[model samples]
Target: MRMLRTTLDHVRLRDKMLLLYFLCVFIPVVLTNLIFYHVTSQNVKEQRMQDISRALEQIKIEFYREFEDAMEISSILYIDHQLNELLELAYPHPADYIAAYDSYLRHMLNNTYSPVYHSVGGITIYTDNPTLLNSGGINLIDERVKSLPWYSKIPPGRQSKPIFVRTGDGTGEQQHPFSLIRRMNYFYSQNGHEKILKIELRMSSIREIFHNLNLQGSLFLLNERGEIEYTTDPKVDTNAKAVAYNELQLPKDTIEFKTNYVLMNSLNGWSIVAAMPEDEVLYEMQTSRNFVLLLTCANMLLPTLIIIWITRSLNVRIHRILKHMKKVKNQRFELIPGTVSRDEIGQLTGEFNRMTLKIKRLINDVYVADIQRKNVEIQRRHAQLNALHSQINPHFLFNALETIRMRSLMKREDETAHIIHNMARIFRNSLVWNKDRVTLREELELISCFLEIQQYRFGERIGHEVQAQPEDLDYLLPKMVVLTLVENASIHGIEPLKHGGRIEIHFELRAGRLILTVRDNGVGMSVKQVQRLYNYMQRQEEMGERIGLQNVIYRLKLYYGSRFELNIRSALGEGTEIRIMIPADRE
Candidate 1:
């Protein structure tokens, strides 16, 4: 220890200060900032990837949803005994068949299902029964019809299941239509008559679905053999023959996302693939890098200047003291003479020590406290800025929808205009989260708009009823709390049902608390699923698919703290009920 001390003492003060600055200030600051920058960049990249992945999943869902209409129509037609009997009758005369066709087939073709499933372009029945008329959506399976590419491709057997196929007009002049095809062999009484059902899907409608999604990438639907059946990439001519997936060139630096079809048996081996550019995914990292660089410069500059000034002052003062000590060593008593500044170095003597202590106290009381206060204020301002930035996208969306609604109104499409207006209201209320609490009336308005939009999509498939007392309408609750629950009910509960279902919302004020209940008579959850959902709601972590439920739970906790209760009860095939009880707030 003594040897080390002697070596350190022999070192010049400036050299020691330089070493201290390199070790304590420069190295630590640079390393910490570098680490901070790296971690921040990684986090931003990961978050963006997650968001893109979720968007890809949503796109896949939407693609399936568009085709779901065609699938449903095919399924309905496949098992329609009336249609089977109509197609099976061996009418002796063409007039007799025409009468029968006009009575049933014409009505079925023109009125029954077309209005319900707008995604269906046309439905045609092909039969080899020579007695039937060849017109009015019923084509005789003659040489031309039999020689069609899609017809020959159907596997020969008793196997009867709907399959999705892209068919053209035989000539290469027009675009191919995506269709669902199924053989009508379900009835056992068929006397060797070949029956085929084809439901042509609206290509424009499918394209619109792809266009409406706010995903940053090219989307492709690949069949089992890796052939691109449908694509949003404008470079490829969709009107041409099916392109091999590998032949399509993507961006050099791209991230690919893929999701396979599981629910639709007809689309068993089909997959949705998305090619997103790396730059698009990590676009925000450039801003983050610039901010980090600026912060690092500020962090380094302030500490460097402070350290240089402090070290210089210490070196000069200590050098003078050392010179006086050396003079005293030559047999002369000498007192060091200088006006000492109020610092740690000044604490070496009696009066100087008292002044130094006073200065230290003043710094702790004023300067340090002021710095902490400013830091808090800066943090508060940053939060406010972030909130404002978050609102920008929603406001922009709302304005765009308003413009679309006005255009629709000008075109005299009242129904479309009304739906767009409801959609706009939903986007505004749900996304622009400017407040923590909203009156029950305002929340109900948002829910009403949301339900209206859903009704437009589902038509008569979705039913809703709201029961609330007039007095309860004025009660306050967390914004979107009820709407989130209603959405969950609509999507998870009602959406999966074949015939669809009803959603009921009830609001009651009892004692000093408010009770809000959202129930759906759709497909429900099992006991274990309910337990898992409860556990998920109780968790303080982010969830991917159940984010809506988590958001509602989080907001309730934020607004009411521990003074809120949420209860979920469900049974498979019976539907679900979510009830919430919170202290009534009038302010």
Candidate 2:
């Protein structure tokens, strides 16, 4: 029974009891919160999707109109059959060329033609062993057929067919010109030889088609030739951060189908890929989130006030028990009066006081002797710093890191392991005793540690990228200030996410300022949360536990004299990036 009581007490009774209370309280709150939030988000997501889809549908109207117009023009060219008959009659005639050309012009004038958005540049018919000179001072009949797409693949003695043309510079694959091809039969001369007509098309309307979308970010049209006919903006800053484009297993030569909501779109052997500034979506969502958050915040405070009231009342009872405890501390345990209050804290502390009183009555003299026996140990060894630093071997921490790494590996999480190992290396430095200031390398390692832990905790719901130089790692930083953010991200930002997000960490040297950043791909904080961070930093002005962001912020003020700047950028469910500037000093 004694051992059972000891085990239960050591098993963390306060936390376990609090956890039971919290689970009962938080579970209902979370379910209600989640259900309400999910309904709101679903409606918003569906509305946004429908809005975007409506825009796509509107673009399709233009597509059908353009295609119908092109087909209608093709019909007109077919009906203007006299131009083909002129070339047929003009064939094998030199002086007849003037008469034949005049007939062709007369026929062209009779045809109805409207302005084309991107029309055939001009039509020309070629005849073998034929001669005709016109107003241009050039004869189309004598011109030899050179390079044309499907020129050879085309079947002989058949109607002209649509040709797949490429826009090329015609010089090298490195220097290519933009071109479009559309082919049809205008005329074929009657003889052993054949004269055929073709049109070289200009895609000016294609430009207008893309432009009308008035998209906000990168928009492109990719056709079967891996040709990018249009791009509103080009990517030059970062190469595809995941894989080389050529190495990607993306759908070959077409984006006609897509499974991911945020993936490329394919249509008409051409796909339109668009990326709008995510900030816009987040900005819009913020308006609603602010309202919800205001309510959430209002609701969240009520419980907090209640919990505070409960904690205060509980603390009062605890203080009463402690008052009796202090009196007994000067001597041996002495019995104290038990409280009439039936509350849990009152009962528990009352029992504790009673037990101490009994022990004092039984072992006052013996306990006094035992106290003297331990005095020599404290007097002979007062090296608490050495003991505190050295006694805590990093073996446990390394093992913890190793456990996380090995577990991630077994689960086939390579990226996760990379992050975890990086974090572990940072902790290796952190736990080292007698280390007041870590170099930039060590500081960076610390940041890496925090990032990996966060990356693991967040999973694919978050993305992260880091850019840093080795020189910066040698600069001194207050230990663990950056690392504390990892915990902050988990405890504060990420705890609310329904689907996870991205973090970007960047360091640069600019105008003597050493810039450090930590960003997260989690549901971002409310303005209140953002405001609370400042309060948290101030709250750290009071002594606190070593486990959270407040503790780390405290250390930062100690080292940097509060002259540092921490700039933040974020949106709900969008993500966050924090950039901090500090003077670079190596010691």
On lDDT, the candidate that comes out on top is 1
Evaluated at residue 196, the lDDT of candidate 1 is 89
Model 1 CA deviation exceeding 4 Å by range: 1-7, 169-176, 188-191, 312-587
lDDT of each: 0.80, 0.55
Q: Write candidate 1's Cα lDDT for 1-587 as tens digits.
A: 99999999999989999998999988998899889989999999888878877777887787787678878877788888898998998999889998998999999876788789778778889999989877868988999888877898676887887888778732342243687888889887556889988888777777777763556778888888889877888797755677888887777898898889876778888998888887776788877988889988898899999998988789878887677556645734455566766776665633533544565567667987899999998676456433533543356788899999999999999999999998887777657445557899999998999898889988888999999998778888877778888988999899998775899999998888999999999899999988976776567653223346765665565556579998999999999999999998896
Residue range 340-376, candidate 2, lDDT tens digits: 5787776787788777867766786687778887896
Candidate 2 local lDDT, residue 381: 36
Candidate no. 1 TM-score: 0.51
Which residues of candidate 2, in runs, are more than 4 Å off?
1-21, 24-27, 30-64, 91-129, 134-145, 148-155, 167-188, 192-202, 212-298, 321-587
- Once model 1 is optimally superposed onto the true structure by TM-score, how far is the C-alpha of residue 209 displaced, in angstroms? 3.1
Candidate 2: worst-modelled 10 consecutive residues by lDDT? 257-266
